[model samples]
Target: MQRYFETELLDVKNFELPKEIYKHAIVVMRAKVGDHFELVTADQKVHLMEVTAITKTAATAKEIEVFEQLTELPVETTIVCGLSKGDKAEFIVQKGTELGADHFVFFKGEYSVAKWDDKKQKKKLARLEKIALAAAEQSHRTTIPTVAYLSSLQELTLAADEKGLIAYEEAAKEGEKGALVTLLKEIKVAPKETKRPKLQAIFGPEGGLAFQEVTALEERGYIRAGLGPRIMRAETAPLYLLSSLSFALELR
Candidate 1:
């Protein structure tokens, strides 16, 4: 069954699919009346839907069952990377979304090989956003991660309740590995009214993050953490982090 994230499914029983979703449901998927699919609404609940009607240009579905479940990371994660050359950003966003990242952020690092100017920033973000949406749906995620850019590393900041990390290759060289382990080993507790804690980790581009850039971010409360003894490519590091997080936060 196909799954879509819909923000307008509240207090409603039946509705026409959005234009994009209509095309996918009616034309692409060849769904007929009485067919079943899934919808994840703003509340993050999964609803089983039955196709109620279908026209050449439109389709409608009705929710018959709602499943209250959690399909997100125990802690919200934001993947912040220095802009890279080529399609690395898209690859990162796609795989990262599937692996349960809550947000994706790109910034200009002191050693970044690519740059997004004011003229093309919107277009770049749009492409990444599309990839994230597809990956989220394919991965059966209830929420789609967001993509955004920062003008510079200095613009990156975290809330007092959030944890921030910088994936500095040098940390791995110096055998500094306790920060990430400690973070993952500790227990996280929150009241029903509050949300899980958030984590935002930064990765460098091809040449890796400059020491000075790491120093500046450290001042903003970002701790330097090592992924492992074996260094990873710019695009590979974020996925590694997401997998480790899933192992500790989800599987454990």
Candidate 2:
């Protein structure tokens, strides 16, 4: 069955589809009254829905089943990357959502090759948000990942209990490979006071993170971790982190 997001969650068991979703299902997909599809509501609940009725302007679906099935990572993950040029950011949000990223942050690095002015930030962020939403639906995710931008590294902030990691290529070269594993194991026992357990990993742009920026993040309690021995491109490193997290948390 196909899946789509419902922005306004309804209390009624039978609900009407929004205009855009109506156009896609009723008009574009040419779905009939008996067809079924999965629906993710605002409350993040997944509903197996069956189309019950259709009018000229809208269609309705009856909630067939409510699924409590887990489709998200056990730990909330935010992938932070230094803003890069071209379509890299879009690729990160698109593929990252499929790989279970809960959120994405892009910031201006000391050696950033691309710049996003205020207007560009708004436009690009809007486009990226759409990419995240579509990817989430396509990936059958219960929750849609968010995309955000920061002017500089200084603007990036973390909660006291949130585990933060900076992907440092230098750490990989120095044979530092245990930090990521250690952090993954430790976050399971992170302070219980943390309302939403979070793990945010930072990656640099094509030019990589500046040494001073790494030092500052370390001072703020972010661990510098190496993703194996080989150096990955800025976009590749976050995906590696997510894959590792899934293997350690989901598989084991």
Candidate 3:
């Protein structure tokens, strides 16, 4: 069934769809009166609704009952990376949303080649947000991840929680174990009575993070870790990290 995220509450009673949604539901999807579909509200609850009336600017639906049981990731994961060139960042946001990232932060790094002015930054963030919303709908995620732009490393570090890891390729070469592995091990060993862990993983741009930046992150209690032996592209690293997380938490 087609799924849509709507802010309005749905009940067995009649309801009207917004103009844009009416076009898609009635004209695009060719749904008619009595057609059924799934709707997820802002509160992350999925409900079944049946179309009652269709109009030029609106469509009405009667909510039947809740559909699937709501299931979410046990741990919240936030991926912060240095802004990279081209459309890679957009791709990262899309795939990251499907893999259960709670939030994304793109920061200006010491070695970052891409620069965005205030106006350009707003546009870029907006585009990334659209990608995230579409991805969330496609993946049936209850919540859409947020994308943010950070001006400096200080701002980026301030967003992290107590459990954070920085994905530095150099760390992998220094005989340190893989970051994904290390984080999983830590989670497994955590006491059941402990609060749910929140993880923020940072990645670098094309040229990677500056040594000074890595040192600064270390000072803030972020462990330096690596993905693997081979150096992955800036765009590909986040996807790799997100997949690892999904396998550890969701697939297991």
Candidate 4:
């Protein structure tokens, strides 16, 4: 059952696939009239629809059945990572989406090696978005994660909420437990009847966060926690953080 995220809520009771969708169904999938496939509408509702007519510009499907299932994380977690070099940012977006990241923010930091101009920034953001959407569909996620353009540390901190954590290796050296462990403990102690808190986990780039940047985050109310004794790569850290969050919140 391949799933596609459509822009509109389809009442396939008497519906037609848009030109792009039609080509994918009729030509790409080689689906013909009477063939059935799973369709996810803009509202995130999943339905079983059968092809009724195939046209040059579109294909029609009749809604046969629907399954109301919700597959989302218990807590909405946004991962804010400092911009890294090369395609590492793209990797973060793709893997982060599969790991159930609700949103992503890339910030230019003092230690960041990659620099993005206006045109380059737009292209990079667009590419990240496409990767996220594909990963979402593959992972059976109802909603695609958002990828934001690079921002400054000041801008990011100003927009952050009270429930955020920043992963800094020095925190562990100071006898603090790993950030993931701390977050899990917090979630476990939270009242079950209460709504889950939104956790934003921030990671630094290859060279890691500068001392001043880390201090700035601390002043902005971000608790600095570490991951482990072994330092993880810039792109790998966020995936690990997100996977741990999903396991703690959703799989628990």
What are the per-model numbers of colliding residue pairs?
0, 0, 0, 0
> What digit string (tens of lDDT, one per residue) describes model 4 on residues 22-62?
76678888898899877777676788888888776677888
| Clash pairs (backbone) in predicted model 3 | none
After TM-score superposition, the amount by which residue 215's alpha carbon in candidate 1 deviates from its true location, in angstroms, is 0.9
Per-residue lDDT tens digits of candidate 1, residues 1-252?
Answer: 798888867544677888988888788898899998888887788989999988778778888998976779888899999998999999999999999999999998888878999878999999999999989888999999999999888878899878998899999999998989887765344433367888999999889999889889898899999989998999999999999999987884
Q: What's model 3's overall lDDT? A: 0.82
- Residue 138, candidate 3: C-alpha displacement in angstroms: 0.4
lDDT of 2: 0.88
Question: Measured by TM-score, how close is model 4 to the native structure?
Answer: 0.89
Q: Give lDDT tens digits, candidate 2, residues 189-249.
A: 6665535578889999989999999999998889899899887888888889998888988
Would you list the C-alpha lDDT of every candidate in the order shown? 0.88, 0.88, 0.82, 0.79
TM-score of each predicted structure versus truth = 0.95, 0.94, 0.91, 0.89
Error of 1 at 160 (Å): 0.7
As a whole number from 0 to 100, the lDDT of residue 53 in candidate 2 is 92
TM accuracy, model 1: 0.95
Residue 225, model 1: Cα distance from true site in angstroms:
0.8
Model 2 misplacement above 4 A: 11-13, 189-196
